[model samples]
Target: MTGPGNPHGGDAGEKSAPAPKKGKRELWKLIPGFAISAFFLWRTIKSIHYDDLRSLHVVQPVWIGVMIAFLLGSYTLRIYRWWFMLRRSGAAGFGVCSRVLLTSFAANNVLPFRIGDFLRVFTYAGDLNASSSTILSTVILERLLDIFTLLAFLVALLLGAAHALPPVVVRGHELNVLHFAEPVLVLCAVGLILLLFGAPLLQRVVESVVRRLPAGARTEKLQRWALLLFDAVLKLSFAGRVLLLVSSIAIWLCEGMIFVSLSRMLAIAVLPRGPWLAVALSNLGFLIPSSPGAIGVYESFCKAAMTSQGAAPGISGIYGILVHVVVFFSVTIAGGVAFLAHRMARGAASRPLRADLADLPVEMPADLPPGISS
Candidate 1:
């Protein structure tokens, strides 16, 4: 059933117009995330003593260049991974996928709980002719796969580092790798089990709860859509799941290499395998769902990871600051240029849909089924 001027007019009476006030509440709901970000940034800045800024010049330009290269490479890999995921989700066209990813990253950096994520879904929806809800569901599935990959990598890194480094040879600083291993593995296993089966369970629970709501066609349709999305997500092919997992790990590894390069460029002692751990930990911090670009959280966590690895506080702080600078500027410049080009091309391609609409036949076919309407 559809209403007058509805794209699909049907036997059902005219659909009610949407309430103008329905979206007003959304503006208010955005305040908390932004407020939290501001508070976090303020506290982070206040916590940085002037002494932490000392020796900032130790980071050389050549090292900065290397770090920048690694950062760019990481972004490239991310684009590739995103393209793969989008294609698997029936969102074809590499160019559109790349643009969506680049713009999403840019939006994430600019907007405050990374609202750019929703923008990515919207962009993909327009480009792929797919539903926003479906695209968003894929994103959720992607994140779940990412968490599993991160846990697996963390466990492996801990085990390998334990064997490679002597327990007490490096002074009283005892490397308690084993201490963290059991708990981390247990958590990873639990998370994996949940990802494997928890989604379907969650859908059933949600359906039961939604069923108790006031009965109506709209409610029924919403529940049906929710179930459909869950089923589509749960039915991801084994190969597609494996691809997501592998790509997720590869993207993180590339990012770690970038961090390690940046650390070295800053003349910080490059731990043989420490950057991998640092990257894993720092990226995990970002998953905390803080502000846009994870400004305060990223810096604080990076510094902490470096400090734990025996780096001088000042040097680590400087490394964190410089890496952020490089990444921010590089992405901003590149993405801005791409965005401008995309807009220009879109403007050139756009044509009036009314021109084609006017050519449609006015009379309906007599043989058409009674329930079928367009």
Candidate 2:
């Protein structure tokens, strides 16, 4: 039920798997993922043109290749952005972070119940010999930054796309996407403002409160991690902040181009705002509590976006499947490779140690950079 050598031994088997009762509970949690994915996939397939699917090879291989290139570039930028943050938090090397990033993505892609997130935290903690608390804080920060960036893009898209969005009337209510999105947009906007203007004061307040507490192990640990989170935020240079936002937006934009590429290949009309909206909306699918990769959620949102842009339902459905396949395989392949290489390298390095020495615990370092303790 477990992997060969346990790096997340301290996680009480949560990393590799859950206990039977917990596992059953997690399986129950998969109901929504399965239902949503099954329903949307069924709907999508029902709309697919059998003849068009048969001739799916009509698209140019070159554009597909270009999409892959952009995907790689986008991932590179994302990893580099993470590296910047990791370094700020006292992580030492880019190599370890790179492998951890890919492995985490791969795990998330393959596993259920979002176990990959735990795997990601444990993996990073193991690689850096850092505490899970500190690494988890960084991971949380990464996701927050990512969400903020995506919300910004969505807000911008919704505002500019008011005219282009297809009409949706449900239960005799003329539903406006912009109106629905406004609340979330306002929230994100307010959060952005606070991060820009009030983070320092908040950090100071947190630091004072945490420092005044007793210095026991738990309190010390909590104090260290709390301060690390704020300090990392404070240490981000203006240029680094720009890089985070720009790289995030650029990643989504590059991904959006896949829709355009597919459209061009399929000889469909999905331009102007279709690809962008599809990209934004489809990504929002990940926020849904669905199966790994948010299968149904992504396809449904994307197909809707494409259909809104005058694309045939058949083509849009097929296009969504194609895009999902391409992205899934690409990330899995890359992540798999990185993960295996890291494991093999670690094995080789450790195998050389004397048998008695190898079993000894390697304590986490005491001298972490300021505002952090392992």
Error of 2 at 162 (Å): 1.8
1-374 per-residue lDDT for model 1 (tens digits):
11122334444343343322323444555666566656645544554566767544545677656666667777877777666655645675777777777766776787643545755654346675555655665665666666666667777776765653234444757766556675877887676655554757767777888879998766766665555446444655666555656677777776777877776655677465656666666667667666667766666666666766677655665566666666776777677676677767879674442432222222211222121111
- In order, what is each prediction's RMSD in angstroms? 9.7, 6.4
lDDT of 1: 0.61
Looking at model 2, which ten-residue stretch has the lowest summed lDDT? Answer: 356-365
Off by over 4 Å in 2: 1-19, 168-171, 202-231, 348-374
Inter-residue clash pairs, candidate 2 = 33-291
Separate clash counts for every candidate: 1, 1
Local error of candidate 2 at 358, Å?
20
TM-score top scorer: 2
Residue 369 of model 2 has an lDDT of: 39
